[model samples]
Target: MSTVFDIEQKQDSAERLLAVADKEPRYILFADEFNKVARKTVESAIHNIELDFSWSKFKNQKQYNVNGIKQVHLLRMQMKESWILDAADEVWLLIDRYKPKRTIGTSGKLKSSGFKHAIYPDPDNPKRPSEILITGKDMILDFGQAFYFKYFSDDAHTAIGYGNKNLYQNRSWVYLRFRLKVRKGDKTYYSNSKGVIEMLVKNDYPIGKTLDYKLV
Candidate 1:
């Protein structure tokens, strides 16, 4: 009978060793350590931009009219294409796995007319029954299935609750707001590049605080 204390001690030792190994300095490094840090900082900023855009696209689905909003534009050319392709691949993979009989959006927007599938249980009608519900697993499966249906169809319209451009722009604003909140004590001095690097140094590499904080 191994005691619980022994098990805990073993786990703790393993974790410490792993952390030490991860931090071990490597020789013959392809890039200078400082250069690596600078590169990673740029990569993270690009990722944040992509995430901001994705969140915006999700929000646009909720708006009734999207014509008034400025068309979503990608400022960084190379990063923009990479983000779109990665997003499309993720959606494609999800669609392949779930294989939903029919897909519907939040506002009762149906993906296909002839396809037959049961709706998730309605909260208002507690007695109603279906194969799907609003749990986390079901949501994941639904996204995968929905992606496939839309990608394959010639007349596939945007999924419900996410088609409006304004929704995405508002989403981008919200993402920027929260990021600034986490990075800076005051919102007035939030520059996407510098703020993020400062936050990372504060949280991850405190020793690197003396380094000049710049994206490139």
Candidate 2:
């Protein structure tokens, strides 16, 4: 085990490296690599759903309110328009595949994504079970899935389906979630962009600590 002094020194060095990475354009390149992986992950998840997709079954379900949060704008799936609901269910299923068994006292009462991931109550909407509990490696998949859902709802161009010539053509929706953006009196830093890139480079890249950090 390392001593406290050594741990502190390592943390300080990491902080310094992160600070320097913020100014470099190569961070963007790293972010690009991460984004590519994200895209493939999302695509793979979508592909799995499509393999057995039953557009006909979706056509039978009545119109339903799919919105999980009341605070967010309300979204409803109109009659015979189950595409959004299908996609959302797929997201829930992916989360279920990796989450641990249901917590004690919560079994059988909670709704499941059908993949066995128990749905938890949403603090934002008590009546709607939208909150999903996840940790560790699954979080990245969650982000990508959530990103895809958000964009797909906003713009059908991102919809994953056969016969759409423009399918995945405009993938800016995927990249947008990782981009840094600023508004009047407010700025948001997206961690999956630079922060994750730094961590991946440090831990997974062969260059290790000797790698030259720069932004393109």
Top candidate (TM-score):
2
The CA lDDT of each predicted structure is 0.23, 0.25
Query: What ranges in model 1 sit over 4 Å off?
Result: 1-31, 50-147, 150-216
Query: Estimated TM-score per prediction?
Result: 0.16, 0.17
Q: Which tens-of-lDDT digit does each residue in 135-183 have in candidate 1?
A: 2111221121121111112212222223331122122110011111011
Candidate 2 versus truth, CA RMSD in Å, comes to 23.9
TM-score of 2: 0.17
Query: Which portions of model 2 miss their true places by more than 4 Å?
Result: 1-58, 64-119, 125-148, 151-167, 170-216
Which lDDT tens digits does candidate 2 get at residues 93-116? 222221222333645564332222
Best by lDDT: 2
